[model samples]
Target: MSLPLMPKATAVWLVENTSLTFEQIADFCGMHALEIQAIADGEVAIGITGLNPIAKSQLTPEEIQRCEADPDTRLKLRPAESHLTRARKGARYTPVSKRNDRPDGIAWLLKNHPEISDAQICKLMGTTRPTIQAIRDKSHWNSANIKPRNPVTLGLCSEADLEKALAVSQPRSSSIFLVRASEASALSQPAAPADTGHYGRTEPQDAHSEAESLFRRPASPAPAESGTETDPDDSADF
Candidate 1:
């Protein structure tokens, strides 16, 4: 969807002139609903001039009314007559004044969006892989001074570029999470018990004959001839 030239101003105008819900106004302006409420409460954007979308041909009066009648409906930006193509992306130069702040921006991206690739961060911040690696390993010369701050806040990258990189990395992060979950679940299950035989060794099961065991008992020795001494002639056949 096309955003207004001035989102905050447009939000202000919508808050003042229309009965549209905060969500509807925020959706149209590409801003948070809380921000729209702040504008209404005079807490933010105190002196900014409101730009009327109707005058800019960015909205039609009828469309506004249609949305005003139904709170669920969202206001749409009118398409421009000549659609301009987006400029091709290329390596960007960081201004010297903001170049020292790149490490801080890199730190923030590393901490907040680990799923995003170092290459993506490099492209977004006009930085290099080595710079990113230093931050990641806490080996940068200014590591102690590097406080994490948003790349956008540092004027190192645009929100759109950061959002696009995160979107690309989302699927990869999800797949990794799923794989880890499966491994954890497998480890949590109890192991099957092993069967042991007579000698404390795993033995194959077989049919046992209980009758054979009962019949194989050794016979008792005959009672010794008591006091029937035949002394020296004991060797003679009796």
Candidate 2:
């Protein structure tokens, strides 16, 4: 699906030009409501030049009005023949000047958002896994001079894209941890009644008994392998 170009900028325009709620603006612009609120409060996107969606033919004034009239309604993008022409997907292009800053951006992502995997970084930054690995290992050619800088600030990617990438990566990580925790809980449980049987019959063991069985120590060592003679005094009890 086609999304608004420069979504943050589009959101800025929406916030400044309309009375739409942050949720509505966020939904239309593919951003967090909090981020949209931040834009309205001038806490972020401070120096960003707003790009008018209507002026760019990405939206119509009527659409904005319709959404404004109904707080629950979402703004829709205006269909354009140009969006169809631009459907070809390929590796993203970085300008020659901005290309050198990728290592810094990669380093920033690695240091700040280590929860995101190498593959997610590759997708978000339009960089290769090898490059990300090198940065993580401090083995990149310019490692000495590399500094952690936001990829959005470096112009390597947009904030909206970064947020979306993080949203995708984090849920999967949480789900994996949840699965592992559930498996661990399952393993910790005592063997079932059917499992405790010697001949596959149901022979239940109580919780305390089961735990004791698992932790029971070995029997006292056999009497010196039936040695010839023990000192008579050694057999005397204290």
Candidate 3:
């Protein structure tokens, strides 16, 4: 267990103000239960003042309440945020050599991801708003010479940073665009009939028409020898 600053003082405060047990206080303050009991009885540290753990950011009122409600629960200190969780403050810096490439990066972001805001571009490329605006309005001194180049390729920012910035700018367009794209793709495809013949071909064949063609009998043989016949008794002299 990690003890709070001024452990005796904090213990004194908890003993005076809360309904927590001596063991809970001891466990939280890293002191023995007997010491906490003596502190509660005002037999030790007679002149010491109570220090509020909430004010010191060592604990939350909710945690105190929870522990007080259940004597078995021990107090837990509120966690402090690390540097990785904190947002950076102030302006970003760019090297002198890379400063000239800012315009190209800005132009690339503007042309490719117009949805990105001026503030986002400034943060991503370390350039000022005026430069962005001048480039946007085609008024930059080197507007004719400036080419739209990727910030990551130009070493202005990492691919991860660029992707993070793009993610922040892309949420609004996601749902509707996906729905429309799916609908367009569905419409472009042709619909197939229910009945298909050989060679993967689809043809409409009505049940009645198919039945008539299948069960219809062949025509009777035509009347034979009605006009001409060969005589069996006739003979010709050689």
lDDT of each structure? 0.82, 0.80, 0.82
Clashes of each: 0, 0, 0
* lDDT of model 1 at position 109: 88
Candidate 1 Cα deviation (angstroms), residue 34: 13
lDDT of 2 by residue, 1-238 (tens): 5678788878887888789999998888888999999999999999776777775677887888888888988887777663332422666677898888989999988888877988778777778988988888988888999989877756687655788778888888798889999999999999854454666665545788778878999999775565567778988954
- After superposition, candidate 3 runs with Cα above 4 Å error: 1-87, 172-238
Q: What is the C-alpha RMSD of each candidate to the true structure, in Å?
A: 11.4, 13.6, 18.8
TM-score for each model? 0.50, 0.43, 0.37
Write the residue-wise lDDT of candidate 1 on 21-123 in tens digits. 9999999999998988889999999976677778666788999999989999988788776333354578778999999988998998899989888777877
Badly placed stretches (over 4 Å) of model 2 are: 1-88, 179-238
lDDT score, candidate 3, position 196 = 76
Q: Write the per-residue lDDT of candidate 3 for residues 1-238, one digit (tens) a residue.
A: 5567668878998999899999999999999999999987779979776777776577888999999899888898766531123345777778899988889989999999887888888898888899899999999999999988777656677555787888988874576578889999999999965877898876547888778878999899887765656555554432
lDDT comparing candidate 3 with the true structure: 0.82
**Model 1, C-alpha of 155: deviation from truth (Å):** 1.7
Models sorted by lDDT, best on top: 1, 3, 2
Give lDDT: candidate 2, residue 22: 99
Top of the candidates by TM-score: 1
